[model samples]
Target: MTFLWRISETNADGLIGTYSRSNGLDRFELRRGKRIEVNEAMPTVRFDGRTRDLLAFDCLSNTAAPLVSQRMAQALRDSCAQDVQLVPARIEAADGVLDGWSLLNATATVRAINHRKSVYTMVPGTQAIMSFRHLEYLEGCLGEHQLARDAEYLGHLLVSDSLAQALSDFAGASFERPEEAYYETMSRRWNSANDAR
Candidate 1:
């Protein structure tokens, strides 16, 4: 089974309803693909009305960092413990503090993108990747692994087929393979171009 996709989720209003990183979050440290030093205040997430009884898997609205329920975190740990760091995080809701959540921090990066087949570039002297017009992975670049991130785009999460299947039942969580996203992106652009006619 050769399936790959990034885990992305949005609420009914097209926003990441239940999950957002605190303003004080050190996003860079999470991107380093290593265990984060838990500060006095570990990484945290804020929840609002939309989160009531919602599924436990979520991603930070702006950064796309994953936040998972304890069960989801444990699933990852059992499958690919070496590829991820289950950093503790708090889920603060209006009524009270909800517990048993972890930030699914990726710790493995593979430069699996076949540059010639992919259209993307890194900003000068920075890790930020822009112009991801196309993406194509090289054969065998991603070996057997449950979760491996993209080297070019630190925020991008690539999950194996098994992992995707394991998380399939989670409500509000969505995953898309590269080609699926690419086709959708291109189709939208094409429709827009034609609509301008």
Candidate 2:
């Protein structure tokens, strides 16, 4: 299966934003004040042996560096507020050099909106702003052992040196902001991928 990851960046008052994509539709939201921005994407894919939906989120907030870090940790805890236990896990970047980041693993039966079992990871980034990436793969995609393997793979990709370099270039560029650059990059990548098809 093909995994197409969409990217977005936002800069606004209160520093809250959301980006959601499902079934070829995309929605974005932003709010003001001390709030947590939840960016969710539900992409369906065939993994393991069955078709499944993967729910992903990138939660970010803007504040003093210290507060941002604090909020990031708190947000991670809040994500698994239900009957779920989070275990500290190691995620190595493919190209090495994973600075100021940590990953947490958990498996839970989410019963609030839908009754489904899921395996998820909470990745907190302690950069200029506090940011957290939450990724959940439905039960079928990951069994007991697969969870660790998949999580590690994802972690490595997230912290890869190549990814870091690209992001750094995006940040240093005078393209208004990283979010705009990210959108453009994703759009270009998507267009190229579709063109080849």
Candidate 3:
């Protein structure tokens, strides 16, 4: 009963930290579990002009780095200390430096995709997956994890049911039901077919 984040552009109300100035930090490095070196432990970043204020747990625009409030970070530490890395980070708004926040880097990845049971498409000619028509996890693949990433589905950060329940009350959190899948390509194909009509 694991869960994954389902961020939406329509939900955010204000801009969020872009980490634009942080040289070593990026989405790829964090998600890939790469060790990043920063001159200062707490790198400063300002809210970008896009949309969304800091939430208890949130990812930046285009779904970049995962950021969490102190409260949420504590919950993550208590639950999945080995599965994650919470790097010290600072967020700035018009007022000043935001305290009690951290960058979440998921360190544990597993081969959790039950490919035989999951419905997905490969990128036209590439080996990469393009979209999922449905998604399912492999039996017994999660082990004893509070948080994790599926090596077969790199786009998401999955949380064990216990951890998901613990953070259920956090405002602006976006834990999705495990049954959901990212199927953007399916939508586009439908739209293009309609356009031809």
What digit string (tens of lDDT, one per residue) describes model 3 on residues 1-197? 76776554444546644565455555576676434554565655677442224543344333456667777788888887888788777777665566666777787787787788778789898888787777777766778877777776676788777887887766546677555544554577789999999
Candidate 2: regions farther than 4 A off: 1-8, 11-68, 81-149, 156-187, 190-197
Clash pairs, candidate 2, are 9-179
Report the poorest 10 consecutive residues by lDDT, candidate 2. 46-55
**What lDDT does model 3 reach?**
0.67
Clashes of each: 0, 1, 3
At residue 132, candidate 1 shows an lDDT of 76
Best prediction by TM-score: 1
lDDT (10s digit) by residue, model 1, range 70-177: 777777788888888877776666556656777777777777777787776678897667757777777666686677777766666777777788877765456776
- Find the number of clashing residue pairs for candidate 3: 3
